[model samples]
Structure formats: C-alpha cells, structure tokens
Target chain A: MNRKKENGLSSEKVFNFCNCAFLLVLVVIVAYPLYYVLIASISDPYEVYAGKTFILPSKVTFEGYARVFREESIARGYLNSIYYTVLGTLVSVALIITTAYSVSKKTLPFKKTIMVFYVITMYFGGGLIPTYLVVSRTGLLNSVWSLILPGGVAVYNVIVARTYFENSIPEELYEAAAIDGSSNLGTFFKIALPLAKPILAVMVIFTMVAYWNDWFTALIYMGEKSKYPLQLALRQILIQSQATATMMGNMDGGYAEANKITELIKFASIVVGAVPMLIAYPFVQRYFEKGFMAGAVKG
Target chain B: MKKGKQGNTNAAVPKESLWKQVVKHWEFYVLLLPGILVTIIYKYIPIYGIQIAFRDYNAVDGFFGSAWVGLKWFQRFFGNYNSVRMIRNTILLSLYSILWTFPIPIILALLINQIRQKRFQRVSQTILYAPHFISVMILCGMLRIFLSPYGGLINILGEALGFIREPVNLIDSASAFRTIYIASSIWQDAGWGTIIYISTLSSVDASLHEAAKVDGANAIQRIMHIDIPELIPVIVIQLIMSFGNLMNVGFEKAYLLQTSLNKETSEIIATYVYEQGMLKAMYSFSTAVSLFNTVVNIILLVAVNKICSKLSDVSFV
Candidate 1:
C-alpha cells in the first residue's frame, strides 16, 4: 500500500515535499547561529567548550546572566539605550508624521519642490568628515542631542509616511472637516494623526531600532565612556576581551577563569542586547507588515 | 524656484506668489518649521562643510577663513601609499558581496513561493528575518565566539569531522575576512530582502501559473518559463540600486571585525576615512578621499537610474 501511494504521488506532491524540506533546512541554517548563542549563554561554559551543546544545551547554568546583571556598565548601557531610543523615536516620529502629512496635502504649496528637496538628499550626502565637522562645530559632540538631532528626520521615512497618507486617508474626510470649520491644524491633529496609527507604529519601530542599534554616533560624539550606548559598550567588551583577560591574570584560576568568563559574557551580552528587540518585535510586527505593504511597494 | 507652483482658483493666480502661498497655508507652513530647521542644521550645513575637502581646514580659521588649497587634498589622496590597496579592496569586496549575496533572496523567494502550508510559511519567515534585527556588535561578537580557534562550534565541528587536525582562528585570518563579511551580511539581510521580491511574486497573475500547470508544465518549468520572466524587471532594478551604492562599504561591521592580522584585507575606504579623519585628524585629506567615494556613488546612482528608466521604466531616482 505504501509502495502504491509513493508510486502514485504527483509531481506537485513531490514539489511540495521538497519545498517544505528546503524551508526547514533554511530555518535551521538561519536560526541555529542565534540559537547556538542562546544555548551557550545558559549552558556550562565547559559544555560549550566541548561543543556538546550543539544538539541541545548541556549542563545548564545561569552564571552568565548573573554576571551580566551584576556588571555596572551593562546596566548603565541599558538605561542609556532606553533613554535615547524613547526620546529619539518620539521626536523623530512627531517630525516625520507632521512633515509627511503636510507634504501629502494636495493644497500644500511647493509640494513638488519640497519632495525634490527631500529626494535629492537620498542620492547625495556630505561625506563623514564634513558631517563630523559640522556636528563638532555646533557643539553637539559629547551630548545626547548629538545622537537625537543629527538624524532627527530621515527623508526616506518622510517619503514612506507621505505615500501612506496620500494613498490611505480619504480626501472627503479632509473636505468635510474643512466644511465643519475645522482648521488645518485641527484636521491634522484630529483626522490625519488618528488615521496614521499604522505608519506611526512603523516610524516608532524603525526609529527605536536605529537608535538602539546606533553605536557609531555615540562612538564618535561621546568623549566620555559613561555616555556609551549598549551597542558601543558591548563592542568595547567584545573587542577588548583580551584586556579583561590580561587584567585578571592573578585572580582565582588565573587566565583560564578569565578566558571562560569572557566567553560566557560574550554569549550572555548578545542575549541581553538582542532580547529587548526580539521581545518588542512580535507586538509591532503586524504594523510593520502593514506599513511596508502600504508604503514600500505599490504591488 | 518652486516646482509645485500651480494656478489656483482662490484669487492667488500667479505662480510666483510665494508670500501669498505661504500666508494662505500658514498653519501647514508653521507645522513644517521643525523638519525644515533640522534639514538645514543637519543636512545642508554638512553640505556647506564639504568645501573643506578642497581647503586646509583649520578649526580656528573656520569655514571661509580656511586656506584655499584647491586640488591639493585630492592629489594627496590619489598619491597616498595605501590608495590603490584601499580602492582595490573596496571594489573586490563589493563585487564579492554582489556575487554571493544578491541571488540568495530571489532564490529564497522562489522557494518560499512553493510552500503550501501557510503556518509553516509564516514561522519560516519569522525565524529567517529575525537575524536582520541583530545589531552589528552582537553579530560580530557571535561570529568571534563561533569561529574561535579553541572550543568554537565551527572548529569543534571541523575537528569532530576530522576535517582538520586542530581548530583554526578564522576571524583573525586575512583570507577569511571577506568571506565572513559577505556571508554574515547575506545571512542577516537575504531573508529581509525577500520581502520586496516575494511581494512582487505574489502579484504575479495566478492565471499564468494555472495555464502552465494545465499545459503539464512541472514546478521547475513553470518557475523558469513564467515566474522568472516576471521577476526580471525587479531584479534588474535591485541590481542597479546595489551597484549604484557599490563604493559605500559599511564602516561599523568592518571596524568591529578588523584585527591587526586582518587589517590588510579588511581596510576599506569608509574605515580608512574614519581613521584618517577622526582618529588622525587628517580632516582635509580624508574629506577628499570620502568626497571621491561619494561622487563616484552619485555618478553610479545617476547612471544606473537613467539606464533603469530607459530599460525597464522602474527607476529609483
């Protein structure tokens, strides 16, 4: 009976089987690296060293997590990341939505000129030194404003939000609001803002991610180590792992303990850094898709 | 001059009445103030600073007071010792990325389009695209650990398989940097990049696939004859966009991954610019080097945008 079914399988069935198998393999390939890190973070550093933690995590331990939480810099980095991401995302979204809504209006003056002005920046930009010089000249260096203000308004986000407003919001609502003696500001605040929740969510997610992941800005602008964001702090820890090891030369178990802790910390820090984004992802994911579909492609 | 100047029925008829237009939509104009202020401060001021590339820019002398050196900085960049090496490394790495990274998304999208199970498809997508959100620091750290000579998963596996006598320090090797860089980028982005293509493929008419099926065309045959032809324009547009920004090798990842051993291969123009401009304070010369990179990028962008428009009516512009 099994032989008969196998023989009777259509090409489509075979294709589906292969397709599923391929995707499963892809899932493993894509996910395993991250999964490996998570498992190694929790596993005995020895099991990880022995490579026995591959198929399943062996000798589970919370020592890495404990160490990470106990680290003062990591805690400070978390606070800094949160502050920047929240403040930056809020400012960026407000600017983007207001600018985009304004540009999306058919009656808005010089709309085409404004669009051209924005789009030109996408193709051309001042190189690093010039931009850095400008930032320094403005006395923005070593300030939180340096991170939030320099990239305060992304033109691409503006364009995307504009497209969303132009395509999604109905003209009748605006006209009706106008007829009802609603001023432009009133219509925008009452009508446009409420209708723009999806794009708003998209902007929030994007801006938050950008601010959270940004180290280069803080790396360049910050003169003090205390101002470093989580990503930059993580970079210092990872890149300067040798320094940590060498410093702990006379500690208990000597260089070996230091090396093992460094490895554990590396794995743990990745988990710490990534967990917030991953946690926030699913909640905003639907809005993300909706926004992308609405703005990114007409198809 | 304004481009969106249109004759209105409300009595402000002339196209040149900027004051009238501004007064008429005063609220909207007011709303635009914050965004415009930011653009001026952050974007245009930087453009004004680009002139420093041509001058001996002294912080004390300021913009206008800076000594006019004309083409000296550009000349110095071209005549520098590592100029050829940096340019060559940048081009080679970009080409390698384009070769290895570009096609995976298209192929993945094709494979994804074949899946019949909706739940599985969604799960796969979530799992796959998750990597895109991983920060570069975390990614580099992960790569460092995974590829370590001692007790790294890759090395351990290799040893277990008897592929080598002992583990190798892959991350620190010059020969391995480009491959690791390209591969990691592909791993991060390929899944996310499929979103646009998959969206395109979904909009491919169902009737065409049905017709092919009715004609006894197999899965491969249908994909080849129908799906790929429909995908060509999008692929071309994407390729053009990638090539246009070819010179902009990202600084963060390369800088994070760079070791003393791998510096020979990993030192691209962006990283070099950062070192010279920020670290060494060779502001003028580094500005010139980066200005060259930007100009090349813009030229490529314009050229490709033109070609794409002419060929496929799908230009990024």
Candidate 2:
C-alpha cells in the first residue's frame, strides 16, 4: 500500500510538472522574439543578419537611436504626436466625463434619447470619403482639429465610464448634494467626478494610447509630414527601410553595406517608439489594468 | 358623475401646459446643450454627407452642388469584376479568423488555471501579454522575416530536419496565409486572452473541485464538467461581439500582409475601402459601399445582441 501511494504521488507530481512546462514554453515563444529584437538592436548588425545575435548583444551600440533622431522629421513627428495625444485626450476625457455624469443622473430629462442618438452613431459611420469632404468643406483640411474633432467621444469608453459610474457611485450621494442646495453642475463637479478616479484613469490611458497610436487621421488629413504623428514618422522609417533594402540590392558589394544596417537597429525602432508609453505604463497599470476589471468581471 | 368631473379636469390639461413643463425643465435642456453641440458638429453633420452616395461627388462642385446620380455608384460597385471576389474573400477570411482567434485565449486560460505554481503562472502571463504592445505594422514586418522563403528561421528548421525539399513561401501562398496569420495571432494574443479565463476559473468553488476529486473524476472530466460550462456566457457574449465586427477586417494588418501572391485571399472590405475611397478618388462610390457596409454591421450587431439575450439571457443591451 505504501509503495502504491508513492507511485500515485509521483504521477500527480509529473502531471503538475507537465502543465507548468507547457505554459513556460508558450511564454518563451511569445516573449523571446520581442526580447531578442531588443538585444539585437544593440548587437553588431553582422551578427543580427547571420542569426548569431540572440540572448545578448555582442557589440552594444546606440546607432539606431542616433540615426532615427538624425532624420529631421522624427523630432517634429514626436512633438506633433505628443500635441495631438495630450490635447486630444484632455478634450475627449472632459467631454466624455461631463456628458457621462449628466446622463448618469436619473432626473436628467432626454437622457435616454441622447444616449440612443450617440449609440446610433457608434454602430454606423458615414464612411471615409463623406467624412473627408465634410472636414475639408468646413475648412479644417489642414488643421489639427481635423484629426481631433472628427472622433470626439469613443462610444465604447463612454459606455464603460457610464457603467462604472452606475455601479460604483451611490445614488444617495446625488440626493444628499441636491438636498444641500447644490446645483447640478456643482454636484457633478464635486461629488461624481471625485468618485470617478478609477474609471477616469482607465479613460485617460485608453484615450492617450488611441490618440498616440492613431496615424489613420494623420495619413488621411495631414498632407505635410511636419503635421504627422510618431506613428506616421515610424511609418516613414519603415518606408525608408524598404527603400534602403531595395537600394542595397542594387549595390553589388553589399556585405559591408549590410553590416552598416542592422536588423537589431531596425528592431530597436519599436522600442524607441513605444518607450514613452512603457514609461507611463506603470503609473496607470494600477488603474488601467484594473480599470476594465470592474466592468469585465461584473458583466 | 364625480368620476366624469375628474376625467374632464384630467382632459383639460392642455398642450400649452406640456410646453410649460418643457420650460419648467429648462435646466435639463441646458445640461444637454454642450454635449448636443459637440455631437452635432462632430457626429451628425458629417452623417449628412451620406448624401454623397447619391451624387457624382465632384470635388470641384462639392456636396450640395454635385449632380445627383441615384444608385449609379452602388450599381457600378456590385457590378464590378472584383466585387464578388472581394466580398467573398472578406467574409471568408473574417469567418476563418473568428473561428480561430476568438477561442484561443480561453483554452490558454483553462490550461493556465490548472497549473498550481504561482511563479510560473505569473511569468507566463507577463511573457504572453508582451506581444499585445507590438504594433500591427511591426508584427507584419516580423512575420515577413520569420516566414521569408530563404534562410527564415522556420525554413531553416524545416530543412535541417529534412521535412521539405524546398523553403516554403509561407506568407506568399494563399493556402498558407490563414495558417501563418492564425499562428502569429495566437502567439501574440493567446496569453493575453488567458487573463479573462483565469479570473473566471479562480472563482470556481474549491469545495466542488475537492468533491469531484473524492468522486474519482480525473482532471479532464473535472474541467469538462465544471470549467467549460462556467465559461458559456462569456463565450456567448464574445461570439456576439465578434459577429458584430464581422464586416470590419482591420485595414493595417491585412494591408501590410498583402503580397501579389496572397492578395487574392487577403483583400478585405477595410483595405478595399482604403484603396478605392481614400487611395484612389472614387469618393462617392466608396462612400456608398462604406455606408452599405455600416448598415450591414449595425443590423448584424442588433441581431446577435438579441440572439445572445434570447439564448443565454446575457447581452450587451
């Protein structure tokens, strides 16, 4: 019986080990290419192309960063993207927060009708061309507002915010504030907005990422690269990478030329581009990750 | 007679008094004004440009001055050579993707749940979530390199093992396109998807699992009985959401992934819209197509939302 018990215990242990091993392999498969790219960016380009660059950098270099910054458009693009994201996120959050707050109130007249109207647009868009014509016709063709104003309230975020407010904010607080002779605006500004920190964090993170990552508007509206976002700039880099790749093909003694251009450096572009958000990630990770947690689990 | 007098007074409340009620609730209107103004400027006014679909949409003439052309654009679009292929490819690709991409994370989540090692689980999750941050453009570029016909990592392994006679052009082949896409998608997303399932699984009753163990049900049986059933509502909601997005094949990834070879299989509505509506200058025709697409999506959305509600009694609505 003791010998039999030992055999059963060892089988369960093996089962446990097998499960862990399978997941660990999955994790590596997903992560290594990305981590490898980061290591490759600093490695010698020769090693990168030869498939010898893995795990660590053979020669550490910041040439990729230096080259990217040397491009005249990179700085302008960074600033443009920053301006767009910051200004756009602020306006979006303000509009969404206030509207969501007012609509969340049970006593607000025409609330249902307004929500229905907004949700209707969420399901249907006028497509690209009509929207473009409308933007240009309004004389916003070359303007920043062309990018910013077209998509004001991301309806999904609004719905999430509304749900958060409904679930989290006690209806009694609104009543108490009203009984204290607080005006609608006062009550909302003081009580509701204060109580909305978690969802607001989520909203800010989402809006920031959306505005930052958005190049569709930049591509469609901004004819000028100076007005382009970082994504547009990154796209320019990729285009240049393609052009250079072709140009190198035309040159015969391409080994040295290839060495000059590193796949690691190319990979590093992603890191450089995403570095800002990664820096900001931890700050909002507390709320941003958990922000959706409230709604997701509750639903 | 007393009831008749009360009814007369109730009927005496005039339309003018209803107007008075509107005035009494003037603050509500005021509260709604700013939001309405923004929506009008940003949302509804642009919607009015849907009239372009009914016109030639001359850039020189603009919307109001453009000559009305009836359903000429729509007729032309549906009558075109590429129309059938484009529509069929879009639906097929999305259908295939939905079948593959939607359920993967749930499976990963279930697998991750049975693992009792806290450190291993945490590390695996972090590794998996990393790919979510990689942009689609970069992901496509990575896919290109990894699937390159010559000296690509995948081919090198295949050759060393004598698995094939020649290096395969994975991305270029229509047959291989879906597999490459699905694999990359799973690699990028499976771990991220597990988060939801793991959360759901943790809430499973410990006592229930203990009872199942006592009943001599093995691991697979326990999972079948307890875990999968618990995930049905989530799966239903996810399905409805996925179906609602049936028409919207994202432009960036598909556009990047397209080559001369796989273009036959890969072209979807979003990329087609990008090319025709924005890239080329077929504004009116493309706008009509887009509007038609939008209508279909909205109808599908409502239908699925209703279906989910009826079947599972769980819905976004």
Candidate 3:
C-alpha cells in the first residue's frame, strides 16, 4: 500500500502523516508538564500529593496560593524583581543605543578604539570575586542599582544596535542634516533614533525578558532577604524544602506532615512566580524573530 | 602672547570634546548619559577586573595589591584530585545533549514547515511552546514523581506493556541522569528553538520548493534538497554557539538532579565552581577553575567559528 508502482508526484501522504505524528509527539512531551503543573497547582495539595489528580482536578483548592502569599517574602521578591528589571533594562538600553549611534558615525574620531574596548569586555570578564570586590568597595553592595547598573550595557546588544544603526539609517539623511548645519548629536537624536524604532522595540522586549529572568546577580551580590528577586526567593524556597524534608526525615521528631506540605508549596511558588513572564511572552514573541533577524544579518 | 594663545587652544580643545559636545547638546546627552553611565559603572568596570585572574587575589589585599600568582592557580587546578571527573562529565553531558537534543528542533522546524494546514501548525506550536515557560524546579518535580520506580506513570505504562517485572529507579541510577537531563532539555527548548529555525526557513525561496515539486521530487527528497540545505547556515551558527558554552553546564538543572547516587554523572564545571568556590569559600581556587573554563570556551569558540566559516556560510563572529 505504501509502495509506488509507476509515476508519483511526491510521498506527501506519508510525509504529512509523519510530520503530523512527529509534531503531535513533540507537543505531548513538551506540553504535558505545563498542563500537569497548571492542573496540579489548582488541585488540592492532599490529592496532588496522593497522586490522584492527573488529567483533571478532583478537588480544587487555592490554599497553596494563600500559603505562598501569606509567607510575606514572595510579595517583596516580586517588587525587588520589578525594580531590578525595569531600572536595569532602561539604563542598559539607553547606553546601548547611544554608544551604538555615536560609534556608528563616520566623523567620530577614534570611535574604533572605544568600540574595541566594548568588544574585548564582552569576551573577557574578570572572575567573580574581583567583580564582587568592585561592587563592594564602590559601596554598591545591597543597593538596588548594584544589580541593575553592574549588568547594564551588554556588549552583544551594543554590537547589534550598531549593526541596526549602520544598516537602517540612510547616509543621505545625515548628509542633509549636515547641510542644514546639524551637529552629529542632532542627527542621531532627530534622524537615527527615530529610524531605529523597530530595532528599539526588539531590544526593549529582549532586555525586559533578560532582566526579568535574571536572579543570579542578586543571589551573588544582594545578601539581604528584603532585596531578593523572585528567582532568588524561589531558589530559597526550594532550598528550604530540601533542608526541611531531609532534616525532618533524618533527625527531627515530627514536622513530617508540615515539611511535605512545605515541599508542595515549593512547587506552587514556582508556578505563581512564572505567570508574569508567561502572560507577557505572547505580546513580545512576535518581535523576537524580526528583531534578531534584522540585527544579526551581517551587513 | 603666543603662550596665552597656546593655553587658550588647550582649553578650547576639550570644549570641542564629545563630553562637551554632549553638554552643548545636553538634550541628546540627557537621553544617552543614564544608560552610558550605568554600563560604564556596572558592566565595563567589572570586566576591567580580569587582571585579578593573574594575581594571588585576597579579599583584604584587593586586585591591585595582590601578588602576581601568574598561572599558579591554573597549575593547582590541573594537579588537583578528581579534576578529571568534572572535565569528563562536563564534556560528556554537553556532548550527549548537543548530539541528541539538537536534531529534534531542526527536524521539528522542517516538519512544521511542511504542514500546509495552518491551524494544525499553530495549535501544535502553541502546545509545544507552552512548556518552555515553566521553571526548572516545577519541571524537575514533575519528573521525580512521574519517573518514580513505584507507581510512577511511566512504570505503570511499562507494566501494562510487560517491559519490566519491576520499575527502575530512574533518578537514582547514574546513567539515567543524563538521559533525563537531555530529554527534558529537548522537551523545554526544542519548540522554542524552532522559532529561530523557522525564521531562517521562512527566508528559503518558495520557488525552489516549487521547482522540486515540478521535478517530481518526493516529500523526503524535497526536504533533503531544499529544507536541509536552507537550514545549513542556521545549523552551523547554532553549532558554534552551543560549542562555545560547552563548559557551562547550567547550575540549576544539574544541581537539582544531583544526589548521592547520581553525582558521578551530574557534576560539571558550573556546579563544581559553585560548591568549591561559593560554598567552600575557596575563592581563588574557584575563580581559577571558572577562569580556566572561560578561557577554554573562548579558544573552542574561536576554533569552532573558524572551522564553521571554512566549512559553511554561517559564522557567529
């Protein structure tokens, strides 16, 4: 039945079938965990722990959320993440765009030198302690900007921005501006910046996602709990579960039930914290392709 | 009079400087300065501390004051017991993940492109993409419960199929850790990874596909001729980038999977750095290990990028 006796256009029948089957399997493998988690999060912890709620919730409960929110640190963690993401992205994008524009100019003497400085830093970074000391000695320790400022201008972003500036901005516009006695600064502000909106939008979404997801910096630099970003808080919650479960199993007389409940809450905390990015992704995803392609296609 | 003019000229020169130009065009500077200052203070300055890698760095002495150790840390790391285990696990895990996990997305990208039915494609894409957002902690939890030897879904299914008399302890087995990690990585990243591939595929000339169809090309042949060749550039780029991060086996996922039973397979450069450097407070030693990893990655990247540019059209640099 599958063999071709005479002439044929294509094995499209088998191809489409195989393609559909492949896609279906991939979808199931990937989506099942997310679906399972969503179902599990809303289901009663008792039922979930007992492994009763697989496809659907037998007993619904919001108690996991109640327990998480009531814990206090989750709320503070959200605020901390927000402060870091917004402030950091703003600062980083601004630096990237300006430096990109300034260096993009033909008239900027020794622009290549500054450009090289930026590029070298991208590939070679000082080890952790030296950076930690720099942050500490500069008295940025435990400060909000400490996390935000330290990672502000990503060199890759600068290069991409420079690419966009070089490719997208027309030289004739600059020449016209110069004819009208516009300075290099004026041309960038009025002409180049406005023309680079598509690239800018892409950078904004990319930066926002990066900043939002970043918790490693805070874990390294920010020692205070109040300053913990959501990821760090989630990490702490996971660590707490590991400690509590192991300790309760090992030495502690009781608290077994409490610890198990706390472990469930650890999983629940991850679900709650991820919703913001999930909600935000669809809006920004369309731009990711366009932005990256435009920036990455070498001139 | 000449000296007075010379002094005026020196002062006049800086006023012609970029910073002065920025102030004169304060509006532009106002817009750009915040980002500039932040990058300089935060990103650029920390990178300047790369010098400390050459020093016998001490917290009290600081980078400048520290004595020049000069590759001493590197020697100690190479000479240390069990350094080979980390090097082995790091390369092996990345190798397995890269070898097995990479093809799924490329195949997926090809499959998605072939599906003429837009609704099916969109729905499937959404389903596949949804899992990428779930954090590793939750995903690992699900894996623990599902892959449990007793009463786990997989084992239950296995029992139904009569594959095993008893369920296997998947997590506890040293061999199983890499399988789980690579599988989960494919699950999480394959769909999202397709976005790049699909984007690259979109640029593939439709005329070529049509020409293949006219020439009586089978579906397999069409893909072989058109889709695979079109994707070659993107594939090469991804290969280079992936090879660049060979040393950085992600801390979170590996650490989560690690246990007394599975530590042999699970430990890699990043986890070792964290445990030895951050946890153990062997700052110099840890930094030395991490610096070694980074240097090696750079060398590999340069080598890989060079080879890729020679072999194919795609090169990251």
Best-fitting candidate, scored by DockQ: 1
Clash count for each candidate, listed in order shown: 0, 2, 1
Pairwise DockQ winner, candidates 2 and 3:
2
Candidate 1 C-alpha lDDT tens digits along A1-299: 66654543476788889889988998999999888888999998888898798878898888778777777678889999999888888888889988999998886777778778777777777778777888888999988889987874788899899999989999889979988999999999999999988888888888888889989989888878898889877887776673343323345786577788778878888899999987777677677777767786444
Clashing pairs in 2: A40-A264, A41-A264
Candidate 2: global Cα-lDDT?
0.73
lDDT agreement with native, every candidate: 0.84, 0.73, 0.73
Worst 10 residues of 1 chain A by lDDT: A242-251
In TM-score terms, candidate 2 sits at: 0.87
RMSD of 2: 5.2
Provide the lDDT at A18 for model 1: 86
Top lDDT model: 1
Model 2 residue B109 CA deviation in Å: 1.5
The candidates, ranked best first by lDDT, are: 1, 2, 3
lDDT of 3 at A298: 64
Clashing pairs in 3: A150-B42
Question: Per-prediction DockQ scores?
Answer: 0.66, 0.44, 0.36
